[model samples]
Target: MSVPPRLSMATLPSAAGAGMRAPRIDPAALDIGIVHLGIGAFHRAHQAVYTEDALAAAGESDWGICGVTQRSAHVRDQLVPQDGLYTVLQRGTGAREPRLVGSVRQVLATTEDDVVARLADPAVRVVTLTVTEKGYRLDRHGEPDLRDAGVRADLAGHAGAGHRPRTVVGTLVSALARRRAGHGRGLSLVSCDNLPGNGSVLRKLVTGFCAALPAPGGEDLAAWVAREVSFPSTVVDRMVPTTRSGDRDEIARTFGVTDAAVVVAEPFRQWVVQDDFAAGRPAWDRAGALLTADVTPYEAVKLRLLNAAHSLLAYTGALAGHETIAAAVADPELAAAAAALMVHDASPTLRPPAGLELSGYCDAVLRRFANPALGHRTLQVAADGSLKLPIRVLGTVRDRLAAGTEPTWAALAVAAWMVLLVRGRTDDDRVLAVEDPMLGHLRTQLGRLCDRPRPHDAARIVAVLLGVTEIFGDDLPAHPVFRDLLTAHVARLLTPTPRRPSRSAGS
Candidate 1:
C-alpha cells in the first residue's frame, strides 16, 4: 500500500502557495547549541516558540536546538521527514493562528549516542529538560529513589561498562562525565518542568545520584559537576493538549499540507526563569520571557493557584460528567468551585510577586480554562495523580492548615479523587482507568475498603487514603482539623443529592 505524502522541505514552496507560513530563518543554516530532553508537545509549543522568537530578535543562527526524545521516537518520526520543522496552531476564541517553528535543527532518540555527544559538546552551552515530575525518579521526601532499578544500575557504573543510561539523572551524569573527561567548559541546565524550585531539586538529585555511584572517580566527578554545571529553575505555562487524529486532519484541510508534527495549544502562555547561567545563554528575555533573580514568587503562585486549581477541576469535572476543561468550567457549579479553590484555598497560601493581583490572576486562569478551542481534557490532566497531588494540591492544603485555615476547597478536591476511585468510572459513564504509577497499590488498598459492607463509607475511605504516606505523607492524617474537614467533604461527596423542584410545580 502507498503511504500518503506529508509536508516536507521539498513541498514547502507548494504549501506556502496555499497560504501556509514558513519559518523566516533557514533551518539548514542554523547550528545546534542547546540540547533539549523530552521533546513533547509542551516543549514544542512553549520553549521552542520562545527560542525561535529569541533567535529572530537577535538575528543569530547558532542557538538552534537538538531535541532528544526520552522514551519513544514518536516526535522524531514526525519531525525528521520534515527536516526538523513543525507547525504551532494557537487556538483562541477569535481564530486559529498557525505558524511554522524552526528552532529545532535536529532530533534524536534517547538511546542514540548523539544525545550524550551533544551534551558533551563544548559549543553546547545550555541543556533544557521537560521530562515531567516522575522523570526525576524522586521518592516521597523529594530525594532520588536509590531503589529504582535504573538508578541502581546507573549507580553501579553501568555507563562505564558500555551500557546506555536508563534514567534522566543517569543520562545527565554520563553526559557530564564525558564532558569532564574532555575538559569541556561549564554549561547551564535549565529545568522547565512544573515542579517548584526545579533547578535546585535537579541539582540535588544529580549530585546524590553521583554520590551513590560505585565507580572510581565518582567523588571527583561529583565535585567537578558541582563546580561546572548550573541548574536554573523555571516556571512554564501553556495549555497544549495531546494532539489527536482530528487535529492532523484539520491541519491538512486548513494548510493544504499534511503536517505530521503539528502541535495545537491555547493562546495563553507564560515563562518565568531565574536569570542564572554558568555560561552565556540565549536572550530569552528579548522574546518576552520573564527573567528574574528570584523566580520563587512566580513559581509559588503558578503551582499553588493555577496548578492546584487545575487538579481540583480535573477530578471534580470528571466526576461531574465534563470531558474538556472548557466544558467543565462552563458548568456554573464547577466553575464556582474552581474559583473558590483558587481564591480561598490556594491564594492565601501564596505570597505572590509584588503588584501581582491574586484576584485578576484567578480570573485569568478561569478564562484560560474555558478556551473551547484548546479541547484540554480533564482525564489528561487528571492522570498521574500520585505524582501530581503532592505539588499541586497537598502543598496548598498543608499551608492552609498551618495557617489555621479550614481548607474546605482543598478537602473537596481530595474527596473528589477518592470518589472517582471508588466509582471506577467518570460521571460521563466512561471507564476511569486511573493512569498513575501506583495504580496497583491504589487498587489493592481501595479494594480492601470496597470489599467491606459499607464500601462507599466516606470516613473509612478518607482515613485509608490519607494514611498512605506515599501520597498524603505522615503529618496530614495526624492533624485533626484537616482529617475532620476531609471526612466531612468526602461524606458530602458520597451522599446523593435531592432533585430540584420543577418551575411548573411552583407555578
Candidate 2:
C-alpha cells in the first residue's frame, strides 16, 4: 500500500487565491454524497477513516463527506485552508504516527442560514450524525424534547424562513420535508452516538417534531419518513481524546504543514452497524465494519460492558483524583473494582452476539482503557451524566432486579454518583471546570440530604435521584432492594477506604 502524497496546507487552492499556494485536492476524484452533522474530532478520526478505507477498497469516489458545523466555523476555516486534507495522528506512547485522510470533500457552516438548500440536493443519499448525545435535546426522561427551547427555535426559524435548522434532528426533518415535497423520497439518517438504540431515538425525535408541526401533509410526511427512510443502529468505538496544543505542533512537524483541525486519537477503532438502509451506504463492511442483520446483541455488549465501565471509571476516577482513563485504569484498586463490577454484575446481564466471546471482549476493553498513550480525560466522559448514566448504568440495575439478583457494583457506582453529586465538585474541582445539565439539580438534591445521617435517608436520596423516569426509563424508586443496595453502596463509597481491598460484593 502506497502512502498518499502529503500536500502542504499553504499550497491549497484557497491559499493560492490569497497570494499563497493553496492546499488542494482534486475534488473531481471524490463525490460528496454523505453529509455529516457534527464536524468534530471523533467523527474525523473514526467515521472519516472508515469511509476513506471503504472508498479506497471499492475504488469508488461517490462516498466523500460534506461536513457541516452548527455554531462555529472553526472546523470550516481550518479545513478549507487545508483543502479538506488533514493529518490523523494515531498516538501511542513514544510513537505518534500520522496519516493523511481525504474523506471530507466540502464543508458548510449550518449557521449560514441557507444551508438547507444543500440538504435538498439530489446527489445526497445519506445524512449521518456524530453530534454528542446532548445534542438530541432529550428530556430528563430520555425522550426527545421537541419543546426544548433550541429545538423549537430552530424549527420555527427554519420552517418559516424556508431554511434548514442546525440541530441534527431538525436538519433531517427539514430535509425530509423538502424531499417529500419534491423528490418524494429521502435519505437514510444514521446516528453514530454512544446511546443505546440511537437510531430509533433519532427516528422518534424527527417523527415527533413532524407530528408536532401545524401543517398539511405532516402525517403523510411522517409516514413517508418512517417507510422510506432507514435509521440504522450503530455502535461506534474510538478514543479520540481532545487534542492538546503540543499535539497540534507535533502534527504540523510530522506532516510538515499546519492544520488547525487535525485530530489525534489512539489506533483502536470499531464500528458495528445494522445493515438496514433505505437508499444504500458506503462499502464500510469491506473496511472491517460488522454489518449484521440485528445489532441488539452487539449493542448490548458495548453499551453494558464497555460504555458502562467507561462511565464508572469516569466518576470513580474523578473522585479518586485520576486525570485520564489510562491513569484511572493504572490504579490497581480502581482497576480491580471496575473489573469486578463488569465480570460480576454487568457482563452477565449482556447477551453477546453469536460467535462473540464476552470474556475476550472485556479483556480487549480493559487493555484499551489502560493504554497509557491515550490521554482520554475523565471529565470528558463524566461531563454528561444526566444524559449518559441512565442508559449506560441503570439498565444493569433494572436487569438485576428482574432476575432477583443483588446489584452490588451497580449500586456502588450509583452511590459514588450520589456522593460525587453531593460534593458538587469533581476530583481537583478547583482546577477544572465541570459542567452537566443536571449539576444544579444534583447540588439541590445533595443539599437536602446533608442533615440526614440514617440509612433510610440515603435510600431516599438515591430513590429521588434515580426516580426521574425519563432518565432512568423506569421507576427506580419502587424497588426496595435496589434502593437499599444503592443506599449501602453510597455509604461505602463515601466511607474512607483505609486498607487493602476486600472481596467485591457481587464478585
Candidate 3:
C-alpha cells in the first residue's frame, strides 16, 4: 500500500516514493463523490481516516469525501488553506502519532444556497452522515419528526422549484426525487451516527421525509429509495477529544504543515457495518472493516455497553463534581459505582457472544475512562442528555420494570440525572443549560417547587418528563418501581455529605 503523496513525508526512506521519501499524491487523482453531512471532529477522525486508508490500500481514488456542514464555515476555512488535507492525531495509552489523511477532496457549507444542487448530482453516489442523534429530528417513538419546523421548512423548500432542502433527511429526499425524475442511479444513505440500528433509523427518516412531500414524483422517489438505496447500520468507536487551540501548533509540528481542522483521537478505532449497499461502496474491507451479515449484535454491544457507560460517567460524574473523564475514574468510589451499574444492571439487557464476558468489558471501559492522557471531558459526554438518556438508561429501566427486577443502577443514573439537571451549576461557577428536550416544562415546575420539599417536587418533575412519550416512549409514571427508585436517588443527591477534616485537623 502506497502512502498518498500529500501525506508522505519527504524526510524518510526511498522506494522512489516510499515512507518519508514519497512525494504527496496528486489531489487530482481523488474523486470527490462522497457527500458527508455533519463535518464534525468525530467524522473526520473516524470515517475520513478509514476512507483514506481504504483508498490507499486498494490503490483506488474514486471515493474522496466532499464534506457538507449544515452550520458555520469553520471547517471549510480550516481545510481550504491546506487544500482539503488534514492531519489525524491518534493518541493511545502509550503512543501518540499523526497521519495525514487526504480522503477529503473538498468541503462545502450547505448554507451556501447552491449546495443542494450539488447534492442532487448523480456523481455523489454515497451520502454519509454524522449529524448527531438530535439531527434526526426524531419523535418519541424514534420516528422522524416531520412536523418539526426545520423539517417542514426544508420539505417546503424542496417543493419550490430551484429551492434546496436543508436538513439531511430533506436533502436526501430531494436528491432521490431528482434522481428518480432524471433517470439517474440511486445513491446509498449511510449513517455513521452512534444510534442503535442507525441504518434502519436513517432509512425510516428518509422514507418519512419522502412521505411528507406532495410532488407526484415523491412516491416514485420513495419506491426508488426502497429498491435502489441501501442503508447499512454500523458500529463505530473512537475517542476523539475536541480540538483545542494548542492543536494547531501540534499539527504543524507533526505534519510540517498547519491544519486548523486537524482532528485528534485515541488510537483505538473500530467499524462493523452490515454488508449491504444499493450502489457500490469503497473497498473498506481492504482497510480492515468488518462487513458483517447483520450488525445488530455488534451495534448493540457498542451502543448499550460502551456508549451507555460513557453517558453514565458523564452525568453521574458531573453531579459528583468531576470535570474530566480521567478525574472521575480516579475516584475508586465512582469507578466501582459505574462498573457495578454496567456489569450488574445494564449488561443483562445485552446478549454478547460466548467468551465475551460483560465483567471483562466493564474492566476495559474503566481503564479507558481513566486514561489521563486522553482528557475526554464529562460535559462533552453529558451534553446531549435529552437524546441520550432514553437509549442509555431508560432501556434498562423499562426491561427491568417489565421483568419485576430491581433496577439499582438505572435508578441511580436517573437520580444523577435530576442532580445534574436541577442545579445547572458547578463548584467553579460554570453554568449548565440542563438542555433536556423537556426543559421548558421542567423550568415552569421548578419555579413553584422551590418552595415545597425538593425531593417530592423533584419526583413529580421527573415523572412528567419521563412520561413524555416523545422522549422516553413509555408512561414511566405508571411504574411505581421507577417512581420510587428515582425518588430515592433524588433524596440521596439533595442530602448534604458529611465533612471531614484534613491531616492538620479541624480548627
- Report lDDT per candidate: 0.83, 0.74, 0.72
Q: Top model by TM-score, which number?
A: 1
Model 3 misplacement above 4 A: 1-26, 94-96, 253-256, 427-430, 450-456, 498-507
- Per-residue alpha-carbon lDDT of candidate 3 for residues 1-507, written as tens digits (9 for 90 to 100): 332223222322222222211213445588877889888899888888788778877788778888888777888877766667666766657554555666787788877746666667777788888998788888866566766887889877875786766677887777777777676687788898888789989988887777777866667678878888899888888888887766766644443444567677877788887888777788888778888888887776777677777877777677666767777777666677788778877888888855677778778878777776666878788877777877667788787777888888777776776667766654333465556666666656555553333554667656655666665665676778887888777776666565222111011
Q: Estimate each model's TM-score.
A: 0.94, 0.88, 0.90
TM-score preference between candidates 1 and 3, better one: 1
Q: Each prediction's Cα RMSD?
A: 3.7, 5.7, 5.1
- Which ranges in model 1 have alpha carbons more than 4 Å from their true place? 1-4, 94-96, 112-114, 451-456, 497-507
lDDT of 1 by residue, 182-240 (tens): 96688988999988899999998888888777656778888898898999999999999
* Candidate 1 overall lDDT versus native: 0.83
Number of the top lDDT candidate: 1
Over 4 Å off, model 2: 1-28, 93-96, 140-143, 155-158, 162-166, 426-432, 448-460, 496-507
